[model samples]
Target: MPGWALALPIALLTLIPVAAVIGAALSPQPEVWDHLIRHVLPRVTANTALLMLLVGLGVLCVGVPLAWLTALCVFPGQRFFAWALMLPLAFPAYVLAFVQMGLFEFAGPVQSRLRDWFGSSAWFPEIRGSLWGTVLVLTMAFYPYVYLLTRNAFVTQGRRALEAARMLGESAPRAFWRVSVPMARPWIVGGLALAWMETLADFGAVAVFNYDTFTTALYKAWFDLHNLGAAAQLAALLVLLVLVMAAAEQRSQRGRSYQVASSHCQPIVLRGWHRWVAFGACALVFAASFAIPIVQLVLWSLSTWREELEPRYWDFARNTVLLAVGTAFIATTLSLVLAGVRRRHADRITAWVVRLAVIGYAVPGVVLAVGVFIPIAWLDNLLIAWLRPLGFEGFQILKGSVATMLLALSARFLAVAYHASDSAMQRITRSQEETARTLGLGSWGLLRRLYLPLLRGGLLTAFLMVMVDVMKEMPITLMTRSFGWDTLAVRVFQLTTESMWENAAVPALAIVAVGLLPVVLIFQRAERIQGA
Candidate 1:
């Protein structure tokens, strides 16, 4: 098939959910809007804004300094902290939220010990179900996004700027502030945009804290109020916020050139107290973000091992693995096709189609879920009605099946695989394809013989990324899963919702464990890039 012919169907399929969302948002709902505006909308907007602000500040504070330290200065444990700092990416914010809440809630160990020491009511700050607690947990879980990008920016494009500033008689710190930071602004902004989007898209963590963000509001509207239209409207609003942030990020990157004249550079070496301070700072962030939460999870899992290790645990694991594997395979395969089309038959239409197909990644999971759910439910109903005339009964394939869930996952994560494959494809010179064509190889022949072999590693990376993301994904899974189709993420949410922290620990730990594969892979890739 021709490239545009292949790309058109994928683009249309990708746009269905987005079209559903836009249609829902445009549908009339004056009463719902009134109630939301009066009772919920303002509070939700304020809380979401506050949460974003807090998370942005927290990530910058933790991620920037750590990136600078690890990328620039050689200090004690620098090599270790370089990768160790990324370990927190394995733990989702929701997992960290529950772990911290379990360990430090009013009736938990820390407060109980403090109460014993005082023998009365002592001043102990609450860490559970609070806005600040949510911010802290999310920052720790997400700062890795900022850190990884910023460190790469610093290492690759920042040295020349810093050295030039130093030669101009600026002090090291001054040079870092005025030169290095500005030079790395585009990357930092990109990372911050990602972090902020994740924060807005988050449901599990904010739900755990009862923080009432837009996502929680959307969930409540759908499940509690039984109003899918209102939920979609809220989702649209969230998408608006995300678009605004994306615009701001692009504007920040505009007119910025990150190229450096020289490719060779040396990492700065710290001395004495400066080294110790940098080392301590990195250690503190890593421990607080990764080590402590993991240890707590391990302890909780040990205590609840007998109760947690039932047949259902295995069932949940199996379901999670199946869903993740299926989603990864479908997403990666479709992404490969779209990317190949773009590479082979580059045109305005193909480019636009590919762009539209990847936009789902920017849409929040809940939004995508609602958008996907409503349309699929409609289609299922229409099919049932059409089939009933032929004596066919109970034909509900799309409503509550693995297929629906996979569609949502694919919509949300196809961009990941697409970008990976596209990058790999771009690296293959046009001469290679021309040569293949000159050798009498058609599209399929070229793909099978040349592209597949060349893109093996990229395909694996794409598959792994999508698999890990699907494993960690919660909102869409929670919203769209069929009856009794519980994955580990759903199990963890269920247990956490019921305040079964110990039981939640098992599934949560399993998620973190599985999530570590991509983190380690990414870290290794970054290490190789840095070495080069």
Candidate 2:
């Protein structure tokens, strides 16, 4: 079969949400547009841009130095810190937001204690609804994107380059700024690009902090204003913003090559106070980002588990599992199909189709939810109109089920599964396929007998990654789920929205625990890369 047979449908499916958002935007809603332009757009634009700028700077500050220290320096606990620095990846930004807020909010322990001790406590910096605190939470949650990419770049750059710079009489710090960092510009840019994308897509964390950005604006438009068209228009703007950023990132790396020799990287030995200073920096970030938040989450969970661990909580867990597991199976299977098509066809059209199909990863969950719901609502209305004469009344079959949530989630995360599958497919040599064909195996036979066995590990990884992502997802689950289908993420959102931070912890802890599954995979892979 031609690749277009599969690739076209997949690409079109991926395009549904974008098309919906764009189409909704084109239809003139004068009142909504006027209101947004006059009142909402100015603040939203500034807030979103400012947040992006701060987060961009924050991640670079937090990720680049730590990556350099971990990859190219010898210090106490260097091996442990290499992986420990990335532990924050297992905590969703929203979870961290609530944990931090709980600690520093007016009634929370820190401020309350300060008030009691001082009888006034006017000097303590407020955290709830504070922009800087939101930035801190987001940076900690997202820095791994930069660290993972930049560290790999640094690792691949052998010590010879640094030695060359040193022999030219350049000081260590100066040489690092001049040579090492510039060589890793592409990787750093890519990492920053990923961080920007997630920051743009974020909702739960900002929502918890009561900070306003495009996501929160779009959400309020949809739910608070009871206006779906307005929400769609806002989502369209966000979609365009993401596309521009992604295009810029692609253009920046277009003609750049940062490849280095395959020689092993020998770390620079730290002497005296510098050794402890390096250790202190890495330890501080790890502690602030991972250790504190986790310990607080545990404490909060312990305080509330008695009341929160009832049967309804199980329902939330069950709902979370059902959505995650269902999406994982869907995404993993589709990823394999797309990967197989790309491998077999190797045509320009097929490659483009696959790329388009996977762009859903950059689309925000809230945007996906709105874009996806429009078509389903339309279909449901049509169904209701047609079936009313047959006594099918008072119900929306499609809109009243889990199908829409699953579709939005699958669309949001299929790119992740596709990348994993594509990488795995690259590992299978053409010779292996040819040999299998010579043994009288057809395409289906080869897939069943050869590809499946070899690709099992990668597909499994894709499944787990997708599952964990879906579990932690908030906006899609919040906006798209049918009534009574609340998952742990949705529960966390609701409780945090109500400022019940302690109540949100049980579910938040569960998500963090599940989030560790992919983190372990990442750690193991990084170790393998380092070993090689």
Could you tell me every candidate's TM-score relative to the true structure? Answer: 0.96, 0.98
Residue pairs clashing in model 2 are: none
Q: What would the per-residue lDDT of candidate 2 be over residues 415-522, giving only the tens digit for each residue?
A: 989889888999999999999999999978998999999999999999999999999999988988787889999999889888888889999999999999888999
Mark the regions of model 2 whose C-alpha exceeds 4 Å error after superposition: none
Judged by TM-score, which candidate is best? 2
How well does candidate 1 score on lDDT at residue 415? 94
What is the C-alpha RMSD, rounded to one decimal, of candidate 1? Answer: 1.8
- Backbone N/Cα/C clashes per model: 0, 0
Candidate 1 regions with alpha-carbon error over 4 angstroms: 1-5, 120-122, 389-396
lDDT for model 1, please: 0.87
Candidates in order have lDDT scores of: 0.87, 0.90
- How close to the true structure is residue 457 of candidate 1, measured as C-alpha lDDT? 91
